[model samples]
Every structure is written in C-alpha cells, then in structure tokens.
Target: MTQIEENLFSEFWDKLNGATGKGFGKTVSIDQDIEFYQELKYNNGVFAAFKVHRMQNDMAARLLDENGELKSFKQWLNDVQTIADHQVEQWFRTEYDTAVERAHLAAEWRQFEREAGVLPNLEWIESTSVTPGKDHKIFWGVIRPIMDGFWNRHKPGDRWGCKCGLRATDKKPTPVSDLPAGESDEPAAGLDNNPAADGKLFSDSHPYFTDHYGSKKNILLESDKLMTKYSREEVRKHFQKELKGKSLMLQASQGLAKTISVSHQDIKTITGKPHKYNYMKNTCCYWLPQLLKKAEYMGWSPDMKGTAVPGHGDVKNWHYYRFPLNNEDSFLVVKERMNGEFRIHAIQDKEHFKENKLKNPFEKR
Candidate 1:
C-alpha cells in the first residue's frame, strides 16, 4: 500500500487494537494512537474518518451491550472492518473526491449521533476523561468548519441527524436530562445495550415512538400527499394552528425537506396575528426520521461507498437510492407531523407504559 494508505491501515489497526485489538500495530501509547488518527482524519475524507470513528463507538456500544462479551479485540477488529467496508460501499460513491465525501460523511455522522442522543458523550461534543483518538478529533475538526459555515443560514439548532427528534427544526443542543424518555444520557455514544430492548427507548414513556415508526419517508410522503389536498400556504396555516403560534421555514431543498422551528409571534400589517416572531429555539426540524426511513424503504438512501459532496452537512448532503420528488420536496416533506398525537415528547411512557397498553402504535400500522 502507498504510505498514506499504509498509515491509514496502521491507524485503523491501532484503533482496532486498543478498541477491538486486531493487533495491527505495537502497543503504542494513547498519544501515538491519537496522533496517527489525526493524520488520518485530516488526510482522509469525512466518510473514511466517520467509518473509522463509528467502528470505535460501535465497539464500545457492543461491549456495553454484551457486558464485555468480546472474545478477542483482534477478531472483533477484523470482523468489524469487513462489515463496515461492505456497508460503506452501499452509500458512498467512488467518483467524487474521497476527501469531500469524507467531510460530508463525518458531518452526517456527528449530526446523527447528536440527534440519536449520542453526541453528548462523543469526543467531539464534550470533554471526556478518555482522550480522543487522532482520527476522532481530525474527523470532527474537519467537519466543524463545514458545520460552522452553515450556522447562520440554516437554524444551527435544527441540523441533528435522522431519527425523529425535536431538534430537526431546532439546532440548540438540549440537556440530556431534558431529552425524552429512553433517550441516551450521552447523545454521541449511542445506547449501551439496545435501549429499545429494555422497553424504555420506545415505550409509552418513550418520546419519539408514541406517534409513529414504520417508515419516516412513508409518513412524510403520506403527509405530503395529504398536503396535495391543500396548498403550501394552507399547510403553513395548518402548522400555525397545530403549533399554536409557531413559525416554520418553508425550505424546499433537495436531499431532505421540512426544517421547522418553534417561535413566538410579533404583529404586522392589517392582520389579526403577528406577521413574524421569535421562533421557539427548543423545538425544530433538522433531519426527518420518518422521511429517512421512507427513503431507506424506497432504496433512496444516499450513496456512502463512493465520493460525496464537499462541505459535509451542506445542501446536497446525500443522494438516496431514488431522487427527490422534485427540488421543492426531495427526500422530505414539510408538514406539522409532530403536532399533538404525533409530537414524540408529548406522549412519552416511561415507567410502566406496557401496563398502560401503550404498545408501539406504529408497529401495528
């Protein structure tokens, strides 16, 4: 392999060894490992770094899950790398500059972790006692600029990744104590042992599962189709009524649709209500979970194996199996889906949801 490739290989090796122990390198100090990873993150694209970083986190999550059932770190590393490589090929394209793709992938991964309630503990988000691997910091640093570039244009609070959550519209990070039931205490690290299995993550007390679950795309599509019965203005009005004085951005972008924000209103011309207002920062829409699920269902998930767009997290994040319905509404739809019964946090069922007979309503339909 080329020197760069060899270094990448060694970085991967070190990560696996300390984490899964494929024995790719000598028992270097953590400092050495971190340094190697930094080069990999900066030199490599976001997707590569993401793939590498995710493997590390996934290993930790698994260890937590099985109570440390790992047979050997080496075996785990080999096994994980093989599987990760296969999965990466599915979403990535080979045409784009690998570096750019890496950038996008890294950003998306960070977004995903934050939305899924894992980012808080992620090396990038918080100051943990454990020093981050070089690749880990490199990956975040690379994506940080990209994220910063879009901070003002897009509601910074809203850009959390897929999987239904309040931040889809709001970018302001919520405290872990504030996250809905079953939501991870640490947003970046993911769950320890399938929090869903414990009947907590998706219970009646659960925040996002109360209203729906099948396919987010299906939900958005269905909602969009339902909107066809109305007009854009009408849909906005629907949210106005549903959100009870909340303002939403009608961003008709590609790849994803519907980035909402909650805010109070201010008055204007000859109208009953205010023309504009300060959107509530707590609730917003960055990524559509139901919509993503639908895209995944439709085989429209963006390619991750090949080259991706530059400036990760910017418009044109990922292209799914299928293209957007049109530029106006790509993989997402703009609707007040999180209203009332649909609002995840509104209907969380924590302690004894099953007893309350609040089985995942989405599972049935």
Candidate 2:
C-alpha cells in the first residue's frame, strides 16, 4: 500500500479508538466494558482499512480505459470513488457519534422511558437536524411510537450520516399510508440496525464486511484477535494475505441452478483488483465468494460477446443469477460466461438491468 493509503488506514483506526477507549498496541485492562468496546474498535478499524485499500484500487482503475489504454489525468477522476469515500466517511462519523450519543443518553433515556411507559398517549416525530436525501427527508414530520419497533429501525443515526432524532410530543401517533409493513420498510443494508440498542455499530450485511477480506466472520474474528495480540502490523499482514491475488476458486451453493465457479482473476474484469467486483459496492474483494455461494439463479442467454448457434455446442452462453444484498433497490445480479473457461460480473441489480442493457442479453425464449 502507498503511504497515502497507509495514512488513510491509520486516520480511520485512530478515529474509531474513541469509541472503544482502547489505546493502540495496548493490552485490554480486563474490564468487561472496555474489553467489549475495545473489540468493536478493532472490528471497525480493520473494515476501514479494507475499504481504504479497495478505494485506492478503484481510483487507479479509473486511470485506464477498457482497451487498456491510458486515460487523461482529468478523466481518471470518477464520481464512484468519491461516493465510496463519502459513504466511508459517513459510516465512520455516524459510528463514532452514535457511541458518544449512547453514552450521554443512556441514563436519561432509561429514566425517561421508565416514566413515559406509564403514559399510553405519547408520540414522537422523527425530525432531521441535518438535511437528508429524499429517502430520509420523506420521514420528516412522520410520527411513530416513542419507544417501539419503529424507533428501533427508524431511530436517529439509522442511515449513514443521518441526523434524525425523535422529538417527544403530546400529539397522537398516526401511521403513514405510504409506509409499507414489515420486510419492505428496511433501511439500506448497513444502515438498518440500531447500535445503541443492539450494541452492534455496523450491520452484518454491509458490503464492506460481507465482501471484506477473509470474509465477515473471519474479519470479525481477526479483529477480536487483534485486541488480544495488540499488533497493528500483524493485523495488516493477515488482512493482506486474505486479499490481493489470492488465487481463490470459489463455487456457488447447489440449488435450482447449476453450481457456478469463479476465480480471483475473473473478478479483476470489473475493477483491476482481484478481490473486488464493481457491484453496489466498490467490488467483491471478499464478498464475491459469499455472493456466489448465496446467489439464486435468475436466467440464461446466448453470450452477446460471441456468436453461437442456439442449442448448438458452441460453448458460448451467458448465465444470470440474482442475489439480494445491502438493500431492496441494490440487489446484485451476477452474469457468468461459459465456454470451457469462465468469466463473470456482479453488476447493478434488477432495477438497473434494463437501463444498463444488462438484462438477459439475447435471452433464449
């Protein structure tokens, strides 16, 4: 990694230390609270480092064209990289602030809920203190129970960079017609859960960890191990080993569709990085394995990139599969090519398939 990327990793790691109150290269004091919090800090730090690495690669990819020709320096600048950075910054900012807010609000909130629980007629409006996107602004002035299911999911800090908070009021609670009942009302993949109530600062479904180096479970495990080992250098070594040209041959789970197999190099087609795919996330530096293993079959068609007689053994065909991840609007659609060798792409989900001409290319009826 370059010095700039190393700096990014350290900057994020230090920022997260505020949450767990653990010093770098220090032993856990054996205090349960500090230990638990310290583990969370390590988890967030490793995830942060993974993304910083992914972002740098994506930015570098923008420097070249599909034909392998160099692009102008100005053209190398892309919006997706910025969006990636913004999400990372927002995720970190919210995580750090949520930790602080929970500490400050815990005692007062418990006492308030204890007294307020006695009253059957209390409601709260979710007011956004910061300007939010249409997705969140739509909930402005919307009322839900002060301490109920809605608050658990729609509470302040629910979205990355969300500043929405509940304002307790005497007004009666009313349901919004536009609101869909369970399942459909979930927030974005990583933003749905409440850290204050659940003590999980990051969602398990966030693409960062879901597709992170060594996988989510492994990453968390490594993060926990880091707390005990207290070696930042070792942390980087383990993370790097699991990622970057690891020559992995991953397979999809058996189901209605034929099992699919992908290698680390095929993933490089989307971003010059072997670990990542250019899906809703930067790419599947690690999540590609999970996406393939968990994916449900969509459909198949003749490969548009090559000519093949229908039903003939030309060995040119396109296989399609859809896997739900992150959010309702951001499903990952995988397209694989078969002709002795193999290639695939995790592109935009169902909503964008048509606009991108990604929907079942030359599908056989």
Strongest candidate by lDDT: 2
Per-residue lDDT tens digits for candidate 2, residues 173-285, read 66656543444345766656654344345666767656543344554443333332333333334435664655455565633234444443444333331111122233233
The total of clashing pairs for model 1 equals: 68
* Deviation in Å, model 1, residue 66 alpha carbon: 2.5
Question: Local distance difference test, per candidate?
Answer: 0.27, 0.48
Give lDDT tens digits, candidate 1, residues 290-323.
2233332111122233325332222222222121
Clashes of 2: 7
TM-score of each: 0.16, 0.40
Candidate 2 to truth, TM: 0.40
Best by TM-score: 2
| Model 2 spans > 4 angstroms off | 1-10, 19-43, 49-147, 167-186, 231-365
Pairs of residues clashing in candidate 2: 211-287, 275-284, 275-285, 276-284, 276-285, 277-283, 277-284
- RMSD for each model, in Å, please? 25.8, 17.3
